[model samples]
Target: MGGPEQQVFHPNANIVRKAHCSSMEQYRQMHARSLERPDEFWGEIAEQFHWEAPVKSNFFSYNFDINKGPISIKWMEEASTNICFNLLDVNIQKGLGDKVAFYWEGNDPEDYTRVTYKKLLEHVCKFANVLKSHGVEKGDRVAIYMPMVLELVVTMLACSRIGAVHSIVFGGFSADSLAERMHDCRAKILVTADGVWRGDKLLHLKEICDTALDKCSKIGHNVEKCIVVSHLTRLSNAHTQKTPGMKPPVHKTPFTPGRDLWWDDEMKGASNFCYPTWVDAEDPLFMLYTSGSTGKPKGVLHTTAGYLLYAATTFKYVFDYHPGDTYWCTADIGWITGHTYVVYGPLANGATSVMFEGTPFYPHNGRYWEVIEKYKINLFYTAPTAIRALMKFGDEPVKKFNMSSLRVLGSVGEPINPEAWLWYYRLVGQNKCSIVDTFWQTETGGHVLTPLPGCTPMKPGSATFPFFGVQPELLDENGKIIRGPGEGYLVFSKPWPGMMRTLFGNHDRFETTYFKKFPGYYCTGDGARRDEEGYLWVTGRMDDMLNVSGHLLSTAEVESALVEHPDVAEAAVVSHPHAVKGECLYCFITPNEGVHFSTTLVAELRKKVREKIGPFASPEVVQHAPGLPKTRSGKIMRRVLRKVALNDRDVGDTSTLADEGIVEALFSNRPPEASKLLKAC
Candidate 1:
């Protein structure tokens, strides 16, 4: 399937007026040098940070070819440094101590906090001491499950400060999911909050943690201590009387006398001058679990020096971030985007960052716009799913806010359709700000393929170019590399600094999953195409590709075509078994607000798909969906959709979904004929 190339959007003269890399020529030269002389290029970047002991030997070594040995990658092997120290102490020594490290926006717009670098250090150090007092030491695992608050960031830094590997579970995850992750990491201590507020609902986080801990105990993995942050309780206590239409104050939090310790109580007696624990560059910094194809989650492990250096460098160049720019990335600290961008990246560059603790639609559909206006945010990074969700409400919510302060906008998590990209550019960016559509994964710690805001010209639906030092190549099904303007599997010919070293506690699995597919290349597990201009457009995952009567069609391509229709807010496409065609496209579409779904609309959508990607790509079944099943982070749960489309009774793990009821609703709404087909099979 093919369509006309999208019109390219160049950087606005005003937007790139003060960019670090002003022209495409400069970016090309720098990227070429990064690949030609990696050691020199990376060494210079490494010097920007504070290293306890610099590398005495080779800067990096790798073995992507399994025939050589176990698949491995090591960067700055002979160096020693503390990621927290570089992110905090180094910046403080550079006279950024009084600068605002984080502008924390709470769930309620009225509640906010600004934390200076000096104050952040004090809090992180004190919390580090608290972890030490509870027997947490170097290499120990600490599980953090808390809401989006200043304390959560403090806990992450604290773990890094004392060389304890932290695993942050998203607050919205079910207790069983939390327990599975905690058990996988064999966490010794658990950090959580009393409760959290999402929109108008109050979720008891402590109760969830208690349940997770109980599940962990049953699995023979016991947490020695649980540190509880009384965030909501403190808010409730401060406001003596309840406000009209607000939930009642949360007064009591269940506690296990010996194992549970209040966060404030531990901080009161802890010292604020705990020294950083230096470790090898290759040492594990954090472990984040991501869903695997086999129904089990795999822990993607990242190291210290390489991960930090990559995050900082990419943050500086990708967003064209200036020194005093107030950057905001609307991602919870639980995800890799938050870990690299929100905490490590901007801070490492001494840039002011915004941390928000609620959904984009919470309080109102305009919450995100309000936060941007309130903070005068310069660089804003968010997901395409969120952008699409906000698009359903029309432009009124965003138009009311002053987005003139924005210089650069970014889209992550998934490939953005042209329609949503145009809406974000026309309304949110005001047609002046550049949109950098980044393409990477949890396995890759930072951006791999993305347009440089000030350098590469933007394409609405394409990632445009690879980041510095990323060598991207497309390969056919037989593993032979496809030269130019062809669609195939996307893979990297070489390793980047931010690439995950291995799966925690399972090195063999890591090798087999990523390296086994292409032998010498790192298989990205996604299909992509390079246009005539060399801009790469990522089609969805390989598994999402459908084969119909010898014709191959990408679900992302069809979904993008479906979303291009004005009435469709979002669309998810999955393949269903068909006796005649081998497989057929099954689409779940959510219409825009106030738009009625009917046969006319469905026919219009199918026509749009056929026009965009040819007749073979037309979806066989079109189901009206009130809402697509998404994770708390705004990623469409396509697996659940696939299961529901097939009318499978056992829809695997809906725990990570934002609303499990959406799955049930989808199943209930499945066409009667489709249900019959499943039963007949």
Candidate 2:
């Protein structure tokens, strides 16, 4: 796909760890053992961690049908253990306290913090004690909305120590978005900072959280407190409070009677020796909400045992992690990749990693290369989007680094295009590293499908195959699995540990959304095909989504904001690929009668959407029209719009359109002036 449109041989191919799995002996061994002896393998993993009490069944059989079917796919069925005990306390007790656990870097150039395993234990224990003093107890849901910082990690572990479920919302989400998650879980305590500094901008995070709370009515009765941490202190509201550092016997307010204290102050009451709350292997540990375009986001709940097992397993084998390897996953903590790899997976393996808070292009184009050289990193994991972005800058920036320490390279978030893969392989890896193109999702928990380092044959643009315990299937619309080599819907045939338990509070929705779509299987909402050699090629989403430059952005979410404007009454969105990005947005705006179009107006509209949503949701083009193609139920016919965006005349079935005349009008009156502006929705 790059240069000659043919794959070229890399000199480092033979040196790759694939020699250890040339025959796929390791893959076959793990796959056969994990599948045939699922219980024994998982049970063994559970025993590795300290437990408060032993459980009856190491795993509860995954049952789709059960009256009390909420995360029933549990592990260590009857066991009780605190996660903090395994993540922090035990490591310290083993004399690993002095070893660096996390090296945190903030967007601010001067912001850098290093935390050792022992100090992490103390912070987590101290914070756990603070939560208890503020009436936070077992079974409570705490919402953590903050920028990528040391406090975020400490908060999650602290909650784990106290047996409380933590729902971490990425800091950039709008207030309405924040409220949706908070209300869904009925979070008793909201932990947020005054503001967050991203590059040069200081966003008022707490103010946004406050505005979001105004729209939430579900947690009115249960919500008890708001714990605010000072970031850009000036951006805070009246509720914001500042403390020099976390200490005991801290001041408290009577607002919640038992709550309303600084994040640092709340931790002093926590005893460093306080034991982590005991948990069943199947207990719901954390709830992460995905960005849903069609409806309310689903709260993908993950249990402790099964999740820990999969996360630990993937981290160990995927990157071929070793004690001295310095790993770095360049993704925000908001996505599943960050939660599992950046936090849980790497730490569980006792491997040191870098937590980056800034963007790839931030400060300079050489930031990532500089970080690797500075830290002596061996494993570099990032998305294809990032690779391509850096590719545009050419190789001049990378020439400054001495990157010989690099060993393994990985790609996640989406399938890496063949062109990007090869570019990353040569430009970044310098023909000296094995590239693992990973493919999975928020629901898959850890890496479900991939050619792990030291395993499987190299395939450009292919995800390779399913990992251990994964039974990959290419299903048709009727839910029939296509065999051998073919294209169809991508689905998982069996239940895995990291699969989401439910759709937050809506059980029926979960069943209808995932189960009903494909009987007896998990619908991945993706389209994939296997090659003759058994390698899988991912086409794109079966659903409506424009993966603009590899960042999954929804047309509906964009159009909804466009319609919010008084001039625009309706809109249809689609994509058209460019040479750089895999795709670009195509927006067809049906403005109100008498409203004319102009390049200035279209540019303003795009800016408006950016203000409403974030910069990532901005539209590339906006075309004003009289009407949009839609169904009788008021659903936009995206298939036709996609064709129109690509400048094609022919399209598929249109009898379903609510207004067939609109399509004709869109084509007949294709405004010459509008095309000149070429604003894409």
Best by lDDT: 1
TM-score of each: 0.98, 0.76
Task: For candidate 1, write residues 526-572 as lDDT tens digits.
Answer: 99999888889999799888898888888888888999888999999
- lDDT score of model 2? 0.71
Question: In model 2, which runs have C-alpha deviations exceeding 4 angstroms?
Answer: 1-23, 55-60, 64-72, 217-222, 233-260, 268-270, 544-681
What is the C-alpha RMSD, rounded to one decimal, of candidate 2?
11.2
- For model 1 the local lDDT of residue 264 reads 94
- All models: lDDT? 0.90, 0.71
User: How displaced is residue 556 in candidate 1, in Å?
Assistant: 0.8
Q: Root-mean-square deviation of each candidate, in angstroms?
A: 1.7, 11.2
lDDT of 2 by residue, 2-90 (tens): 22113434325544433334447667887888778877766777667787787664454775443335323555567777666787776
Off by over 4 Å in 1: 1-5, 241-248, 676-681
| Residue-level error in angstroms, candidate 2, position 435 | 1.5
Worst 10 residues of 2 by lDDT: 1-10
